[model samples]
Target: MEGKNSQLQQRKDDALPRGTGNLCQWYVDQAENATLRDVEGNSWIDFAGGIAVLNTGHRHPRIVQAITDQLAKFTHTAFQVTPYESYVALAERINKRVPIAGKAKTAFFTTGAEAVENAVKVARAATRRHGIITFGNAFHGRTFMTMAMTGKVAPYKRDFGPMPASVFHARYPNGVTGISTDDALASLHDIFTQDIAPQDVAAIVLEPVQGEGGFHIAPPDFLQRLRALADQHGILLIADEVQSGFARTGKLFAMEHFAVKPDLITMAKSLAGGMPLSAVSGRAEIMDAPGPGGLGGTYAGNPLSIAAAHAVLDVIDEEQLCERALQLGAQLTELLHSARTTYAAITDVRALGSMVAVEFADAQTATQLQQQAMQRGLLLLTCGPQGNVIRFLYPLTIPDAQFRQALDILGSLLNQPRS
Candidate 1:
């Protein structure tokens, strides 16, 4: 059966289009902590951390055990039909820890896109507005509405045709490319003046630290200003922490770095310690705006995922992985900085906790670096609008020895002359 499955995957690839974007040449046979063994029996350190979904590392013992225990009792009981304590308990825990000031509530979903969609529903329902403002280079999701909200076009939005209306894009504050907080605010003002009135907007959804948009960190001032603008215009402020949540940015949520409070926050990625779960937590008044029947899904808060989420939360708190993120981030930034001196093609080195990134001269160079690293048994991911950025998302629970080994491999790869 295993051989048949492998053959099926090989055949499937031949039938699949190149547009789908293939990462590795072989299948992942097993993974533990921050290491993955390919079908060929070669192991590679997982610096990508499953795109920030393995904060507790792959197959974390607690999460695995929790899922196993839940399987013994029951697996699915659709919360809306036969409510479960795990779902309610997980939601309550998230509500209490979401970094909000006032009363907060949480709703669960299966993916980050669903959480974002629900957040939009809550905002539009509460404000009775039609328009939403997202930033340039933003990546919300692949769903029809989120695709409309996303600012980038190329592979994600091309040919999708006539996206949802009333969604506008403003410049995000990026110091490297010269976009400033003032510039971002100016764009927002322009949107109100030219695109839609402030009162007509339902929400301004943003990433505290953008994921697919080259790992740009939204300046504290910019976030504070946006918060004030939302308050002034009665627009809901939604922080999409799908990638930056669960200690990815050395905080429970990236918004904790700033004083601003968002009316809604969408989180997924590492929320379940590698299980499939996403959530929307926000001001109770705003979240409750949707009718009781207007929210939820059959597989939204699956029992197994909920159990894993509870274990993930407990592991994070008990292990103090947040502090570990800071320590690891600093170490990685320092190492990358040293390597930059030797690699002229390497330009920028920036990090927020373990969410670090390095930009090359161009996409071709980034691709070459990634290929070369993979040859040497290291795995990495490329980001940025131009695909010139290499983002590191190593799990916080990765042992120092393995983490350092991955860094050594990366350092050697960076020192090699670019083609």
Candidate 2:
């Protein structure tokens, strides 16, 4: 008989579409905290954290209990069709935490893409403008408007166009590529002079830390300038914290690190501790720009997700995951920095709290490191347009001993002779 792993792989090949990229070959049998077990009985340490969706760890009891409790009562009522208190309660919870000033409101959606799209929709309605701005190498989402807003070309926006109009891109400062903040700001000015004028712009959307753009941390002055420019012109500033929010950055929200505030914020991924939930919380006036029956989905803020989100917030407070993220990030950043001496190929290691990444010389070097990391039983993921950056999104709930073990394994791979 064929081995169970092989059998499952064959079935997966026959059943699923190739478009749904499977990074790991084996299916997970069970997971708890940072440990994952495959159906074939092999154990692996999780470092990807389900693409930054499990900051509280996989299957936290609080979340499970909350989800279970809500399941027994009811699953979906389509909040717009028959509103629920859980949705309002969760919004209130987020309202108190968002970095926005003054009164704020929140709207829920099912995925990060929906939150992004809705944010832009509200921005357009509020500003009554057709133009939006984004940054090169930044990732918003995969939907039509977001895809247009995204700056990457291949894989994400390759034949999907003709993309939506009035979505412009400014250069995001990347030290690795020698782009300075001055260069980035100059590019924005160029966009105004060369493309859409600033008056026609509705909002400028960016990831506080560019998640899919290789874990680039936005500089404080960059954000401040954006805020000032948004005020100078009549535009909204949107912080896409979908992958970097909810204590991932050693803070409740990564934008909290910056001195400036965004008019709107879109969050998801870890917002519900792995539950499928996304939300847009912003200024009350802007969030209310869309008229009644304008901004909701059939399963938006499903009761189960709302309940799980409430438990997630409670767990974040009880477990102090924000402090844990800082502790973990310091350790990982130090290891990555030290490993640079062992491996000359590593160009840089950077982190903002637990959102850490190490960049290699090229895509092949990074890909080799990823495969070798797996051989050592540590799951890793690559990011960036060149795919030369290895991002570490290990759950903050990972045990110290286990996390150190994973780090050592990675150091061994990085120390290997250049491929």
Candidate 3:
């Protein structure tokens, strides 16, 4: 008598570890553009965007065709074993596009964590230092080194044995949370004075726009200060654009918004339009510090992923998704700000382009809104260290009519009395 979704849920619960959490109970039967259909025929407007991995939307035709073309030719040859033109070509394209100064070099990987880890490797190789400094509420990755670099502890680090050493945390500026730019910088200096000396630190990695910690846009002045500090200390500045890249932030890269540039940048989500591909681009000299074979994987630049990445770049340019991101984000931000008047539970609404989020007065309120929106056939995701911020990661390619419908559902939910 169980429905297909219920049956699948039961099977999943039995087969998978609880650590691999599921936000929706229903199983997806199909997905396209900005909508997902469950096995029961219910369609949900997707706002999670597969956690910012679908800036170009699900199963985009161009990306699909590119993947199909590669599938017909080859899947994997291990770039390190047998070099491929697509991998080199993709790196060249990225090298030209990255915001780093002086010729940049890019290397591909399989995931955000891999890109981040390799960035650190390159930084250490170049600077001859082993220490890494990240910030509070930063979610770099689930790997041991990244886990240590990550600032939050509850779920990401919980039950995971001791993290690799030489990683420290500093405060990230949050005006809403009362941590200012000065305070964040002070925390960094405290780490230098109290924990690791500046000369010993290889890199200071941070998200230009913190994703899971809540969509807090790093203030421009703060970034400038960090650049100055990094320069003064001979430490590399790494912008983890894993969640903020690929036109999601009204620009191809969030670093484009600031005048200061990073020595290296880590990217993954939305890089290959849902294909598992990550990359780190940085100054050529720093990237080359790692000897050959020191920075590649068996599946680093799978031909299929490379093909998809090419198509993704093409689609972003052809569709003007960067400009579209700005337009859509502006509309959503205006809506949330307008809703603030009626919803007392809405404490803050913030955004950097379409990477938007709304913080409620309490975690319960945020979760309630997410549940209510899901019930209305709209998928939403909640984040923040306290679980009080609901982030919107809707694809930039979402049709206007569908997007407007999702907004209406959210408006109605917000206008209602808090339960």
TM-score of each: 0.96, 0.98, 0.99
Give the per-residue lDDT of model 2 (tens digit) for 1-419: 78788898889889988777788888899999899999988988999999999999999999999999999999988998889898998899899989999999999999999999999999999999989999999988888988998889878899775998899999998999999889999998999999989999999999989998999998888888888988999989999999999899999999999888899999999999888999999999999999998899998998998999999899999999999999999988888887777788899887999999999999999998898888788999999889999999998989889998998898777666553
What are the per-residue Cα lDDT tens digits for candidate 1 across 259-357?
Answer: 988989999989998888999999998889999889999999999999999999999999999999999999989988888777888878878988899
Q: Which segments of candidate 2 are over 4 A away from where they belong?
A: 416-419
Q: Report the lDDT tens digits of candidate 3 across residue range 13-68.
A: 99999999988999999999999999999999999999999999999999999999
Cα-based lDDT for every prediction: 0.90, 0.91, 0.94
Q: What's the number of clashes in each of the models?
A: 0, 0, 0
Q: What lDDT is reached at residue 394 by model 3?
A: 96
lDDT of 1 at 29: 85
Clashing pairs in 2: none
Winner on lDDT between 2 and 3 is 3
Q: What global local distance difference test value does model 2 have?
A: 0.91
The residue pairs in collision within model 1 are none
For candidate 3, which ten residues in a row score worst on lDDT? 410-419
- Root-mean-square deviation of candidate 1: 2.0
As for model 2, its CA RMSD to the true structure in angstroms is 1.1
Q: Stretches of candidate 3 above 4 Å error?
A: 417-419
